[model samples]
Target chain A: DQQVKQNSPSLSVQEGRISILNCDYTNSMFDYFLWYKKYPAEGPTFLISISSIKDKNEDGRFTVFLNKSAKHLSLHIVPSQPGDSAVYFCAASNGNAGKSTFGDGTTLTVKP
Target chain B: GAGVSQSPSNKVTEKGKDVELRCDPISGHTALYWYRQSLGQGLEFLIYFQGNSAPDKSGLPSDRFSAERTGGSVSTLTIQRTQQEDSAVYLCASSPQPYTANTGELFFGEGSRLTVL
Candidate 1:
């Protein structure tokens, strides 16, 4: 069973525009959510994360918002750059459980 | 040298052969993890190691899969009698600890792709 899901297979946006990627989870036990960006032939790289206690977190140009009631989360990239093009994955963990479940990634393409 | 490193970046083998993949976690990191990614699929959890304690191998797909972490630094994943279904990219990651206070973020190595004919 897929505990986490990213419905969009791919997305395209113009440079300097806002890019939004969405994710949803069915596990209520997951307390922490993270977003990772992966490039070709490389492993996923940590981008940003949010705790269950907070509804939103922002780092530089990346922002993550969580809606506990809806079991949904989103990653938003402002002023998207060509270099930001990559596959984005959403993952979740439950503290010491130490095992993270990932969603099928969304490939983002930024046209310059 | 600074981040997690995996060896045998690419491997191709015939069916019924066994394959071994290796991972070297960053220095001083006590937590290690292994995952597999198939084409057009998300990362699938395989195993986790913390220090000298036992590893969590719950996500292992079958009895043919086994892994071992030695000296709390390096790990090797072994697949026996490999089949075409075993072909995928294997990834390794490391963290300082299990919780958010010390090692919430995981540093991953470029995956090793295995192809079984």
Candidate 2:
């Protein structure tokens, strides 16, 4: 019962290029989604999030697109940098606090 | 601590031994959660606690697994007679607001890696 899924295990892109990460969920009840970036031996840092009511959310070079009807969302980083290389996780949750379900994670590597 | 803190970053225990992992959430946060993850695997929900409410332990794998939150701040996860399969990273997270249906974000710890030999 994997409610959230990130099919792509790894992604590679060149510096200053666009990096897109995809995520899908099976439970329509989920109304909030978030993305987190994790580095080796460190906690996952909060990146960005979107509510089901909105279709898109952006912050600086990071943007999150949500397609509620399709139960899918994606994170886009424009002009990706080497510092952006890390394991990105997509998590979803319903009304339950502290009960978010997480995807396996996508490892993104930016080549300089 | 400025963020969630988990102790015993790495632990190696023999099979059948018990182990305890600790987590200290942010000072003012109200919601705390525990999750397990294997290498290259997704986070697995283990338990959830909010304020003084009863914890949600539906995700716990078995009776051998138990956890408790004390003084509404620190949490301890104890595994009795740990099995080889019990080896995994234990992560703890906290949220300022109780994540309702509309919004919420989690602040996670680095996670405690457990190895059962």
Candidate 1 residue-wise lDDT, B1-117, digit = tens: 698999999999999999999999999999999999999999998999988889999989999999999888989999999999999999999888864453257889999999999
Worst 10 residues of 2 chain B by lDDT: B96-105
User: lDDT, candidate 2, residue A57?
Assistant: 93
Give the per-residue lDDT of model 1 (tens digit) for A42-69: 9888898888989999999999999999
Who wins the DockQ comparison? Answer: 2
Per-candidate interface DockQ score: 0.66, 0.68
The superposed Cα distance between candidate 1 and the true structure at residue B48, in angstroms, equals 0.3
Looking only at chain B, model 2 earns a TM-score of: 0.95
lDDT of 2 by residue, A1-112 (tens): 8899999999999999999999999999998888989998887888988888899999999999999888999999998999999999999887663587899999999999
**What range of 10 consecutive residues in model 2 chain A has the weakest lDDT sum?**
A92-101
The whole-model lDDT of each prediction reads 0.92, 0.91
Which tens-of-lDDT digit does each residue in B10-87 have in candidate 2? 999999999999999999888899999888888889999999999999999999999999999999999999999999
Q: Which stretches of candidate 1 lie over 4 Å from their true place?
A: none
